[model samples]
Target: MSTHPHAPQSHVHDTLVVGGGPGGLTAAIYLRRFTRDVALVDKGNSRLRLIPVSHNYPGFPEGVPGTTLLGNLTAQLERYGGTVTHGEILGLRIEDGVFVADCLPEGAPDDARREIRAHTVLLATGVADAGLPIEMWREAIAFGSVRLCPVCDGFDVMDKHIAVATSEVNPVGHALFMRTFSAEVTLFERMSPTALTDDDRRRLAAAGVRLVDSPLLSVTLDASMKPVLHTEDGQEHGADVFYPMLGENARSGLAAKLGAETAQCEEIVVDVHGATSVPGLYAIGDVTVGLNQIAVATGQAARAATHIHNRLPPALRTASTRPPSPGTTM
Candidate 1:
């Protein structure tokens, strides 16, 4: 809904936002409210769209569907005359003190690419979860049988039978976290059990988390629409909800290409204002090393937009506007 399919290719914007997730859209809104020329480009793969419903996000007593929330934000941006360009940015570089983004617009040919230029750039590209090997896993997610974030939806599964599946060498952490929400928690190690240390076993046991070391062969839904796990050892385990703790892949390649600092997990490192190591470039949301929540993303967007506005040259005004002294308010 935020997309402008026929956006001009040559106009340079004040700030170009990459990603159409909550953070990117929020930033575009703020920049537009500040009267700055802003352009947003989205590849249409935001993880927020995968959320069935969110109860943790404030102001939604009855909860809101993910798609509905995204649509609301897009609509808000449009009210401010801000539009998003549907495209996949293939490359980014600095040319004459401006950032240039080479993008493949949606439905364009492989050889066809467009260049978008901006004085500053913000990357709100979110992460992709390492999904389960089950067919129709997304359908299970929509049915509330498979969840992604424990911090976000653990309360919804309180006192319910929950299964945490992971291929990590040590899988006790998430299992223990799940124990706080439910009495019956199972940790399914989808890899060799020998990788787990004795400390991991003791911790899991102390937390009363059942450790099932058998490799996960497949996952299916029972007649009750609950997730039933099939182990390689010819065993079946049923649970009210399934959580894949396999981890995630951050979409920070664009920032990395500009020599931005990143963590071992490839999450972009940013300052308090969301500015990356590369000057005039910023990152927010799950792509940055921080809490992956909608509230956090919007807050980061606000801070980044304010900082960017202050950094850019001020527009013409009749009266001289200057920053107030420290400990003083204008």
Candidate 2:
């Protein structure tokens, strides 16, 4: 973790990026390359930190751990004079033509608050998924006994027994979606009141997806280290991978606070350039609507940074190497 305390003054930045995950780090690199003064504030709870391995990302045939990938991105950004500061952004507001945010520094004194002012702000705050119901959840994921994000790891579970569990009111759609990847798919509708609607039953029958009305009891590794799901009815279902269909909670509170439009899922609505309804306020990565993946985040970051760079006036076009000193307001 990193910390920076403000000396009772506002620090002006060309762009202030929130969330130090893939999107924010990539945006920092791009902005620094464009000679813009950019700062990334991260609370260090990135979903990427939980990934044991990613098999779909390009340039890594052998697969790469999430932490490793994040480190690589951080190094790349630092090489270009961009760095991530660990802080929790407590408030965000726009005044004049600049965005101002208040932050609490990590590992610093309780009274050491920091204020950041920027011409532009990018919210790359990612989302979090409800993990599987297992005591050794992290170990299970590391051993491929549990998995999430069918879009990212569906290939690994193809043609294998897949168990999906979700807490959504309507878990049928997620169950049906997983059927495309494997025929041996079982959906555990544990939290749904009306677990299956007429349409849901019809679709599940058509897709050959087995429906388990019983709630999950426990999950543990079997002899071969495979995930074994035990149900309330004392029935045990063994699978190659136990996938949780639990929906993700997007970290879009700041965006909503700024009156930005968001989808029902709380994902920020953004244009192709990652600009939200508010000018100079942008969003990217899992925080925005689209495929929630690292590659997608980096692309959105690139586009947003470029758009911000091009939108600046000639006088402010040059990259800002130094941040505003204490007491300096934008």
Candidate 3:
């Protein structure tokens, strides 16, 4: 937790990056190399463990998992020269020439919070899965069954029986991607197919996707940790792989509250430099409108770091010198 309350934060350093996913870590890496005093705060992205392997990312011909990618990025950040604080940012604001943030550690913080007054702030708050939490969902996750964003984990479903549980008429590109892995793909839309357009219907039909238009009532986990979803229309379906093609609301509430432009899913509209509507508050990753992937997030953060470094105020901005002392002349 960090912030700057009163006078301009001349000592709070160069930047404070929030959310240590791909984006935040990349931002820190670039900022540290440029000699900026940057700190990273993460709420521990839980989705890391679920991504079995990711092939879309370049440099890894065999592909890598979300957890492994994040771990390597963390090491790079620490090695290059960035401090990491495990916490959640509660508040943020901009002063004369610095950005201020108020935060506290996880669990309980009776205001054990600290203030980080810096020259810039990069908000890489990625997205959280948007859905009604069914009790059995947790059980499904542990057994590596119910997958989110199949594009990120669908490869593991090769030659296996898989079902898509969602509320979209066609579930868009998901049914297509899943079909490549498992021919036994069952597309379950918790709604009526009539809600879909003629083109949507044609595309799905051409794709040979089986559509199940029924409301999902509940999820029952079997002994093997497989999910047996009971539909409201009294249909029972089971699959070796349960893919929730359901959509999600981005983690942009904080940015929105600060007057950053937002749209559906709270995806903030950020420029190429990660600059938002506000001057000091910036964004990266799926929380913004650009492509939502590990590589996209990492690239956006790197570019944001370069942009922020170039825009730092003269006071908080530092060169290759020792940290300025309290009474030291500027």
Q: What TM-score, computed on C-alpha atoms, does each candidate reach? A: 0.92, 0.88, 0.83
lDDT to native, each model: 0.87, 0.83, 0.74
As for TM-score, the candidate ahead, 1 or 3, is: 1
Could you list the CA RMSD of all candidates, in the order they appear?
5.2, 6.4, 5.8
Number of the predicted model whose lDDT against the real structure is largest = 1
Model 3: pairs clashing at backbone N, Cα or C within 3 Å: 1-103, 2-101, 2-114, 2-115, 2-116, 3-115, 3-116
How many steric clashes between backbone atoms does each model show? 0, 2, 7
What is the lDDT, from 0 to 100, of the residue 81 in candidate 1?
88
| lDDT tens digits, residue span 1-330, model 3 | 222222243567677788888788888889888767777778886355556667778899898877898889878877875656778888887777567777777775556776767767788888887674444786577567877766666776698888876444345467777778877777766654435556766777887877776766666777888878777789888878777766776888778877999976789988879899987788998889866778888888888888888887543543546668898987
Query: Candidate 2: lDDT of 58?
Result: 92
- Tens digits of lDDT, candidate 2, 28-74: 88888887777789999888888888999899999999999999999
Ranking of predictions according to lDDT:
1, 2, 3
Worst 10 residues of 3 by lDDT: 1-10
Candidate 2: stretches off by over 4 Å: 1-10, 166-170, 315-330
Q: TM-score of model 1 relative to the true fold?
A: 0.92
Model 1 lDDT tens row, 48-134: 898989999889999988899889999999998888888899999999888998889999997989888888999999997775677
